[model samples]
Target chain A: MKHACKRVSQLTSDSFERELSLTEKMQLKLHFAMCSLCRNYHQRLATMAGIFEQMREHDLNQDIQLPIEDKQRIQSVLEKEK
Target chain B: MVDKQMNPKLWLKEHGDYLFRYALSRLHDTELASDMVQETLLAAWRGHERFKGDSTLRTWLVGIMKHKIIDHIRKEIRHRDISDRLEHDPTSTYFSENGSWQDSPSAWRDNPEALWDNQEFRQVLQECLSHLPEKQRNVFEMRELTGDDSETICNAYDITPTHLHVLMHRARLALQTCLHKHWFGGHTKS
Candidate 1:
């Protein structure tokens, strides 16, 4: 059971990276049904994924400005290369 | 005729910030990101005559930037093994010897969606990400923010699938721990 908890946590993380096999999926479900701790951990992992998606969306609207000096510097460098 | 809209100066004014942010999010270094944007613009200018109108100017510029970012990362990872720098067994502290969680995750009082709406929460998320180790940060950003596939990431980083998984797992664990402490009002570990 202890090893199963470790595997469950690992599988939770793996779900985001790649597709899991049917056996992996079944094992995780079984573990979650019996372990409230693993269940909470799984929920938090899913929540974290959602939060990351929000961050990506937020980045799109983020006001990240390049400095005027850097812009001019780049222009000068480009001219030199031309 | 070269597109009159392809003026380099005008392009800089309009798309510089967006490109810089894109590079910054990926590279996480101000000077390096700036250099990348500069290189991207220079390449775009040089290749302007060949640029067909099928793609938007911004898309073309970003497309250039993505290749540049990939090239830079490839060169970087070739110098050393990124996994060597990782902290050993980062998740072990949270789990007991028996493989059960030593400290089970607590329910966050604040709704995550609501937190996303809060600008401060977003800022904290960035801070947490920045706090991650270099390789882990790179892997996480490439996978999550850039939306690169696992195969591409593994190939670019010169890591096996198992190595990639472990790095990502450690990165997520660290980020969650950081957010729980800093954003969710959990105890700050020393």
Candidate 2:
């Protein structure tokens, strides 16, 4: 049961990056059926991804600005091109 | 004719900060993110004629910046020791020789959507993220936060899909463990 949880958790993360094979998907479905611990593990990962998306959205809503010196440095480089 | 609508000076004054913020969010380095913003403008300036107008100028600029961010990560990872992590599960420490979680995960206090509006939770989330090792953090950022494809990450880091999966798995494990301890707090170990 413990080892199955480990495999399921790993497969859960892999599902984030790619499509899991049919066999792998079945394994997760079956494991998750009987395993609440792995279900909690999956929920935590999904929540982490959600938090990042929200964090990015919040950052977008803010009035974040670039610093003056960096702007000046970039302008000079543009000036040199002229 | 080269588009006169695209002006480097104006873009610098207007779109610079948005571009910088976009880069900073992904790169997490003020200097480098700022540098990428400048590089995006210069590249846009040089290649202004190449842009066929299917997208807004800001969108076009962001498209360029995305590539810049990914390429920067690729360069960084290529030079570093991706091999050091080699199929070695960092979470093994969290598990016994048996695969049960030493610290089994529990439900977080709030739902994800509600947690978004909570400033304190966001602060703790950022702190947990900041605590990650650089490579795992980068892998997580590129794959999760930046929405880069798995293939791009796998190809750039010279690792297989499984290795990339392992890297992200390790990151999620660490981040979840961290969030539980810091955000939940009853079980936090010093």
Candidate 3:
């Protein structure tokens, strides 16, 4: 019975990831305390978030260069609209 | 022409990178994407009066770009894969899998705030975003990656706010789940 309940709560990733209200966090925390599976699940979520953050840093350094001609062309087009 | 409410040039200067990147990701052509970016700027300038500053300047620009993307998509030939549907509707996998959290915990168990603060993570996320359906990817990119508001995003995509929310919700959920599998090797650990 307890294991089944854990499975259901894990499925609520949408609700969990969205900006939860304080009340929702408190409720989630309370539930986690009671359910070991939820505790583990929440931990995994943290790990995944950490990995994603690191990847963003790497991408930021990889320059997305807009060539001078492209910039000029874009500028010229916008200038014409004026 | 810069409007009284917004200096079109300045807006372009500040957000052109993101807008261009957004366009490039979808069209997959640098020149065309840049052209779309410029078009979005011009269109925004012409329609500046309609913009009441209800949403951020970035969001407003994205909304214009969204229309341009749709117009572009309609003009071009899209190669639709009949097999793509099988990958999208993953309902069968969900039910058939063993119901066990012991192997796969939730996702991002560490600090939620810390999840997006790293370099490699962003690259993986970018790769993941590329894999999403075009519409869902665009919506996700605008909202999550670019910090655009839900209302403005809906307006840009010509979708109901409910639809916008649903798309965003699904995108994030899929991303979170996929990243978990990648980082965890199919087995989540605290």
DockQ for each numbered candidate: 0.61, 0.64, 0.30
**Candidate 2 local Cα displacement, residue B178, angstroms:** 1.7
Ten-residue stretch with the least lDDT total in model 2 chain B: B181-190
Candidate 3 docks at the CAPRI level of acceptable
Score every model by TM-score.
0.82, 0.85, 0.57
Across B1-190, the per-residue lDDT of candidate 1 in tens digits comes to: 4467878877888898889988887787888888888999999999988789788899999988888887788888877655544447777877888988876777665666777888877788889999998888988888988777787677678788988898888888888888888877654423
lDDT of the candidates, in the order given:
0.81, 0.78, 0.62
lDDT per residue for candidate 3 within B20-47, as digits (tens), equals: 8777755668888888888888888888
Q: Locate the minimum summed-lDDT window of 10 residues in model 1 chain A.
A: A54-63
Quality of model 2 by C-alpha lDDT: 0.78
DockQ of 3: 0.30
Evaluated on chain A only, model 1 obtains a TM-score of: 0.86
lDDT of 2 by residue, B1-190 (tens): 2366577988899899889877886777889989999899999889888888877889999988877876887788767754545646577787768787777677665677787887777788778878887777777777666667777667656678777777788888888888787776553423
Better-scoring candidate (TM-score), 1 or 2: 2
Docking level for model 2 = medium
Given the true complex, what DockQ would model 1 score? Answer: 0.61
**Native-to-model Cα distance after best TM-score fit, residue B180 in candidate 3, in Å:** 5.4
| Order of the predicted models by TM-score, top scorer first | 2, 1, 3
In lDDT terms, which candidate is top?
A: 1
